[model samples]
Target: MTDVPAPPTPVTALLRAPRHRVSPRARLMWQVAALVEGAVAIGVLLLVDLAVDQVDLPWWGVVAAVAAVLAWVAVVPQWRYAVHRWEVTETAVHTQSGWWAQEQRIAPLSRIQTVDRAEGAVARVFGLATVTVTTASAAGALEIDGLDRARAQDLVAELTLKADAVEGDAT
Candidate 1:
């Protein structure tokens, strides 16, 4: 006789959605970046199709790839802009991020191990940065991307000070 599968455990949702949306300029930043990425992807595909003599890549296949790129460039950034948000309270840092697969995270100040900011070439050009909050949790670090550059700097400094004030790091 086969063993029966265990029932899935029900989990309570503890955190509410964060209060603040990212900078409005974030949408333009995301759109530009996506366009560059899509162009590179299509260029690479064309190169591969040209280089491979054994395979005659059909016209429909090329058309489909370009269509997919255009759709992603048009859609994903707007979706992500709508979904992404972040806030920091005295107790915790809350964030919601991603487009297709979203994540909502809350990291307690006491559990915070580090706070850092990052800016890619594209992001820097757009005057945007990402803030990462490292916490002593199994779920991993929480990141809030596409924040205003100065705002990100302020967040990093504020989190560092607040996290330092908390007693024991629950690590």
Candidate 2:
């Protein structure tokens, strides 16, 4: 007697993690982004604390703010890089993203309405780009960020071709 394993059901397939990780440089990019954001937020707090004499913020408050921002800069980027991943197949594109809260999305080729690639000023400095896939679903678009500039462009073209070849507008 032989035992055969059951095939992967759609639900199970959706639960499975995607195969590819974002570019390793994404960690550096994320870290820089965190630092920039922390700087802006901390700068604002310093202004409020220093400029507004009417509101005397405790020294601990300022210390806590710095500690929080430093923690975010130290943790978020590495966590995000570890957690975020994406993949595209003949039938669908899958993605998982986030640091604190994770989100997973699957978009089929037949349902894809548009594919776009974006390069943020900061991301461009790192030679990275994001590819966005818009689908007919009401949930909204799926974004695969932290890809190499060339890779993102290639993904956009590949998705466009695959979506175009499919028959019927997946509504």
Candidate 3:
């Protein structure tokens, strides 16, 4: 006889709902960062091309490198922005992110060791912040980025409180 797991409850259903999304400005920030990175990559490739030219190497190599970088810069940010999402429920913190390979993570409150909030210079300019949740799992910390500054702070505070309330082996 095969064993079947029990069906999801109302709470789980609510938690699984695709209702939560990152701040809209996150897309802009991600795109802008991508552009900056792309620019740097292009600059380096151009320098490499210059050196290669001096050696009479194939110009196609440099063109290919720049094309690859441009494609990555153009596609990845939009894909990530469309997919990234996070939700904090009473039981756990759920996050979904990534571009080509999607990833979903759930960190239960009981296993949470700490909650932290951070803001980079670019994020500050956009009034954005990232919340990092440390857990006992071997996977290390989970970061929920691109949240509005105030929302990130609230999430950090709430997660801290929840983690405090739970009793577990929070290694």
Candidate 4:
């Protein structure tokens, strides 16, 4: 009797094996950013409270508001750091990010139109960079943030080379 070959596994299964995590510095950066945002939010809330002096807010209302802001500033950055991950394979660039709502995206090398590296003022201070991969999809580009500056540059070069090597449309 002739032997039959095993069925090929789906690409999704292969892609799900594991993911690489971002640097610990990412958490620090996020915490700093979150603190800044929390401060702004608290300022706005306080201003609103002052403007509506006709109606006095309960003591618990003010306490809860402050507590919520503090909790967000203290917790969200760490949660985000734990969830954000990225991996570059021969076939695709996979990225997963989010805290409350998770998102995973895969961009095939063949679909890559451009690989860009960007640095914001805060990121520059931390020596971090974000790598953006533009593809043909309508959802826009995929971003891999919190990479070291050198690592981001290397990724850009590597993606560029891989995209160039692939000959067909990745759609």
Best by TM-score: 2
- Report the lDDT of model 3 for residue 39: 77
- Candidate 4: where are CA atoms >4 Å away? 1-12, 169-171
C-alpha positional error of residue 83 in candidate 4 after TM-score superposition, expressed in Å:
1.7
| Per-residue C-alpha lDDT of model 4 across residues 35-82, encoded as one tens digit per residue | 778778877877787898776677797789778877887898889888
Ranking by lDDT: 2, 1, 4, 3
Q: Where is model 3 poorest over a 10-residue stretch in terms of lDDT?
A: 10-19
Off by over 4 Å in 3: 1-18, 52-71
Write one digit per residue (lDDT tens) for candidate 3, span 18-96.
3478888888888778878877877776777677757543678667867887777778878888888898888888888
Error (Å) of candidate 4 at residue 94 is 1.1
Count of clashing pairs, candidate 2 = 0
Off by over 4 Å in 2: 1-10
> What is candidate 1's lDDT per residue for 92-140, written digit by digit as tens?
8989998989998888899999899999998998899999898889899
Which 10-residue window of candidate 4 scores lowest in summed lDDT? 11-20
User: After superposition on all CA atoms, how large is the RMSD of candidate 4?
Assistant: 2.3
Give the Cα error of residue 85 in candidate 1, in Å.
0.8
